[model samples]
Target: MTTLHTPRLTLRPITPDDLPRVLTYRNDPEVARYQAWALPATLDSVAGLVSDQPLGAPGWVQRAVTLRDGTVLGDVALNTQGPQAEVGVTLARSAQGHGYAHEALHALITHAFTDLGLHRVHASIDPRNTPVAVLLTRLGFRHEGTSLQSYRHRSEWTDDALYAVLAAEWTA
Candidate 1:
């Protein structure tokens, strides 16, 4: 398991104990608005979801983002493919706008490129998510393009915005 640290947060492997916090946010309508998980995430389901992914493997791994004092603020998901990774982040409602997401993601991206030897790190976000778009742009990810009505989300057609940062282009 890889543990990443930022000045204000730590990104560590998600554990069974963190499932309650994970369930809370996963069920929050606002938090799930842009996410694809089924609503009302149960404890058993959350555990199953976490247990299903293999950490440090060629697949999705979830990391719990915490404050230095160990307060759970959110989680980051990384789906590793041979020389690339797709990343996603979710924060507790109270944690939004505090820049913790940026700090945690920066650490994850840094590790992905520098330690994991990935050639590219990218994120696919809903087109309606302007905040995340801004966040990715601020972190040096280029707006490659948007897939029109790429998938049906919550009974509506949703566009996906693709943002990417190349290893050579990354600062850390």
Candidate 2:
């Protein structure tokens, strides 16, 4: 079992029991505003989204971000393909601004660059998601570039912001 504990959160594979908690944040308009997934994601869809996360599985590894009291705050997802990986984070509306997202992201980045031996970790975000962009920058991810109108987010086309960090940069 691969589990990571930060100062305030435990990162573990998303389970079937986390449906409601996951949905609470994942379905919220505030959280889903800049996300690629359609808002009001159904329970069945959320279940399928996390069904393949088995510990250190190589495809899409999604971990439930939980507090010390076992309350699900949100989730962090990493997708690995070949030598590179991309990551994303989501937090409940009620859990924002607490540094929980920061803690969870730091732990996951460490795992990606150290435990997994990935060459580079990257993130792509809707250009309008300023908070996430700021968080990624603070974590030492350099803004690589922007892909204009490269993705269709929700019902409209949106630009994508690309950011990345190398393994050497992380281990330093």
Task: Go through the candidates in order and give the C-alpha RMSD of each one to the true structure.
Answer: 1.7, 1.4
**Per-candidate local distance difference test:** 0.87, 0.85
Q: Give lDDT tens digits, candidate 1, residues 70-172.
A: 8889999888989999999999999999998899889888888878888999999997888899999999999999999999999999999999999999964
Residues 1-172, model 2: lDDT tens digits? 5789988899887888899888878888999898777667889878865654544367777888999888999998888888888999999988888888888999999998788888999999987889899899999999999989987766677899899999999999
Best by lDDT: 1
Model 2, C-alpha of 150: deviation from truth (Å): 1.3
Error of 1 at 51 (Å): 5.1
- Model 2 per-residue lDDT at 96: 85
